[model samples]
Target: MTDRTDETDDTHRPGDQPEQHRVTDGGVTAAPGREGAIPEEDTNVTEVFPEGNLDLRAGADNCYKCTTCDTSCPVAEVDEEFPGPKFQGPEQWRLKRKEDADIDGSIMSCSNCMRCDSACPSDVPLSQMHNEARGEYVDDQMDALSTEYVRNRILSNYRTSAELASKVPQLANFAMNFGPARWVMEKVLGVTKEREFPEFAEQTFREWWRERGGAHVQSSEKRIAYFHGCYSNYNTPEVAKAMVRVFEHFGYEILVPPQKCSGTPMFANGMLDDARRDAETNVENLASAIADGADVIASCTSCSLSLRQEYPELFDIDGVEDVSDNTFEAVEYLRIYEDLEGELADAELDGQSFGYHGPCHARNQGLHRQAVELFRDVDGVRVEDVGDSCSGISGTYGWKEEKYDTSMKIGEEMFEHMKHAEGEAGMTECPTCAMQMEHGTGYDIYHPLELLEDALVD
Candidate 1:
């Protein structure tokens, strides 16, 4: 509601300045404690002040707002509370995160979708804004609820995954049983009872890559390492496999090098410290790969977006900084296929009609049209674009029992769109959105590649 577009739109209550924020008790501005030295970060009594108008200046230099921004927004339509990044980034953040609220919750429900940036008419670098906001919050000690959740999930998933992997011989096969497993997690670990979490794959995408003799391509002219993120790494190895297939189809060798997370989840959830740790690990692991003529291609939208942008923010490690720019999402990478003649793999469902649900993170990376073009090239693929909007599943935010009804409610319109489409599946590039579509609408969801891979020659 608060528009920061106008330079003169600022309305500060009498006493606040750039130095210290004023606390208001009801209508009256409360005086500072004893020392009126308009506080700084070092002194802390938890001061409160109205947010300043933040101008992400995203309108021009931002990731152009595309239809996908609206499509992937979790609360765009249903909740009058949010008007999308156009509203939040330039308007709310101008004053709040820039001036008042902590960075973490300042952009609550954003889910780091970055879809807005993807769909931005002007291609605003929205992912950058959100990441920067979050970093600011962490530096300023922003709200830690999301960060707390992220920390717990990381530890919880790691431990639980190890335990589950211990019980199941093939982890990938066992991941299919996440339904019952998630229920158990609800009662035991208190991971929001309703949220759906992906089960860890028995074999990592990297492991699968090696088994497929991916290592033998050491001498290939085209070598692109795929950082499959945690979801694709542990649960949806199929997506990575599909990407590998596509890469091979183009005569490119796909590498599954040793790497940790991109740190978007950690930063978004307030695990600034933890996020830094993950970023550092990735930088160290990818050192050889990036330096050795390897290009990074990724399938997980969130992971791709994170590695391309957020990693530098978390640690500023020289290794990641050198190559993050070279990373590309599956869709981004596939565009090159378009530049050259390409064939569809999952062409079996080529004519099968479906709607495209871009994830916020993927949107941020600006890949909807590229993805749309990829499927459109297929004989049976017909994509009806849902345009800009959130899918209401802000990654794991939609997984909590308390957030279940709300998450689905936020995505109700998109759900209906998928339901009425008469398509064989609800297609999205995000794993979390796939989970949301299935859980929210009881519809089978497929990554665009899955639809194509099923049509493969082999």
Candidate 2:
């Protein structure tokens, strides 16, 4: 871990002589009399280094070693290899700073869910540090130019794969399911054949939006651009449709832009450069809509977290602050709308009961009860907080052969709870969690927006 904070700050004093500022990597030029600081005028240049390239200065200094993060880690409860977030994060951070080799491979298991950061009593940025270290470790160990690297890169650049799969849905779905093809994928790409992957849609959400002339919807006092992420656009267009219908019912003029993936899959799989590229494209695409005073909303909680929180925290892309400020999860947006305009349209669900699995990323966003609150507003819908447990399929983490068993193990508790819980169907904010929960318990699962859309009154 390289510490940038140890470098002296160039605070200008009246008597101090101006010094030349050097340009750093990624083309970011610093102002005169400063070190590694971005010029205020150049919004394109970022002062923040890409993930794993920079280290936190005194990041773990606040750690009292109370092990609160350890106790709170959902991953640690399942995998003993992960000595909990404290060991893999704060404690390991200290060891790595002293000696790089002292840090072990256990850090790779971190899902970068930011739960440890949230649970830390001393506010240690544990998850961030662990992610950074994982990057460093992989970079040192793996040959980036190798065939294995290429396969991993392909797996990580999920947007590209999804687009291709969507274009040839049947072939893609068959290839994924076929035994011989699965063996080839496991051998060549390190993707596991044991777990089921979500099938790509023949008609994506954006495709459906274009067919319906979704872009030309009449403008209203309340306006929003739907950031229907890759999963909705590729694998589950129904969820996106439900979101649009529900939003329209509430008098929101919805704008469906052709958007790229939220780059979370890339981030989770250690493909930092790919994630940065996707993030840049999205920020550029949303700039105009955001300037026109439209709130950017996403149905997927992970996508919302990526836009609303991860962009600034991980990439430090220019103009992302504006996007982050404007972005909202669909349910979060609904809650805000209700707060401003009074209760939502009294939608009748006919007394349907559902269990809610708060996605780990959603929980990381401090949205513990907001999903339930949104569901509670629906007439005759029962929404229970099934627990704050993780679904354990953190992005593409569970799809790799090496991680399949551990991923299933991590999700066992959540799966068991859902199996026994009383619910006609499962409700969640994440598409991946919905898939995992369904696979785990064989229950009909849905995003809450889907249910709300079905139950809309008048």
Candidate 3:
């Protein structure tokens, strides 16, 4: 396991880097990511800032030290060394990566948990910023490996979850019992092990959409082409169905466009190239939605986070790539159209208590808080704002043994909160957090939207 520790303390020296700290025993495996990759100046570099991604840079600069971001971060909660986005970026990556150097490798630890985005006081959108910063580290080869790995290693031979279960007992109940498997994957692969990955559902949302003839696209009115992120599309088809139902209640039409993975889960794994290619495909398909003036609404928080945030940074590196701009978190899109109650609306109280975990991408988008409010509006929803940032899952960061203990240690605050919360169950808008919370507390969790979909008045 890599001797990874959080290093973003307030007093971090300007010259410090993740690589700088890896020298304790006089020798270490020569830092894997940066050694072979040579920084070559190409059209891609020029594309990164065509007319220039000035707005992206400018947007990153906006922040006030409310510590809301630092305060709420799940990773920061555990790893005090990670100085939150406000510190890591505008403070670190943006300044360092531009040196045309290897600074991009240093941010590999972000985990993409996004607790800071939820807690940020200013409009920094730190979640998106760090995502972009991470994108800068990508190259084509990285993408190829993940595709090769998932296709060749896991998906092909591992015929069913049951087969995967033989290696890791938790994989048998992957949707629920993924923590231990993820823990092992992290130890061996450097991937975060804490994430509650979506089970490859017996049926997918796309298959369901096909059964319904790919839900008609209502071009005339303001519409949404809901991009069911990985989990919603695969394991949690009900989440996608529920979202469609939620939108339908308002007479909004949904077009199940031919979209695949948003690549965020892969991206979090540092499989940048695969993520970039996935971004390219998504951008092209989504252009039709943008052309129709429809906002690309997504229920999977990470996908929405990637589309609105990472796609632009990674795929648009040459500056000319066209990813649709009009994207919204499912809740963000629904919030504007539907009025939420001040308290839990129709949530089944039947002696039920609830814990609310916010997703990082949603938090960064300023929708995490709204998600909490949405649950609060539910009649029987008992909301405990656990207030921790990333849930230490950092997507799959918690799963890696190298970062495993740290990730769990990082998740301690939320673990304590969830343990103390008087809830019958836990719910998070972010899928990754739901997985992490479940592992930490052994409490069943659901996305708030599924709950909303069930409770909505037709």
Question: Using lDDT as the measure, which candidate wins?
Answer: 2
Total backbone clashes of candidate 3, pairs 3 or more residues apart or in separate chains:
46
Local accuracy of candidate 3 as per-residue lDDT tens digits, 125-157: 565556555655544223546533443223212
> What tens-digit string does per-residue lDDT give for candidate 1 at 79-119?
55555665555444545634644443536555565555544
Preferred candidate (lDDT higher): 1 or 3:
1
Q: Which portions of model 1 show Cα errors greater than 4 Å? A: 1-109, 115-190, 195-202, 216-220, 337-351
Q: Rank the candidates by lDDT, best first.
A: 2, 1, 3
Please report how far candidate 1 places residue 158 from its true position, in Å: 5.8
Q: Compared with the true structure, what per-residue lDDT tens digits does model 2 show for residues 39-87?
A: 5456574433222345565566567789888877877877776788877
Q: lDDT for every model? A: 0.61, 0.74, 0.61
Candidate 3 or 2, higher TM-score: 2
Between candidates 1 and 2, name the one with more favorable TM-score. Answer: 2
Model 3 RMSD in Å is 12.6
Candidate 1, poorest ten consecutive residues by summed lDDT: 1-10
Clashes of each: 58, 0, 46
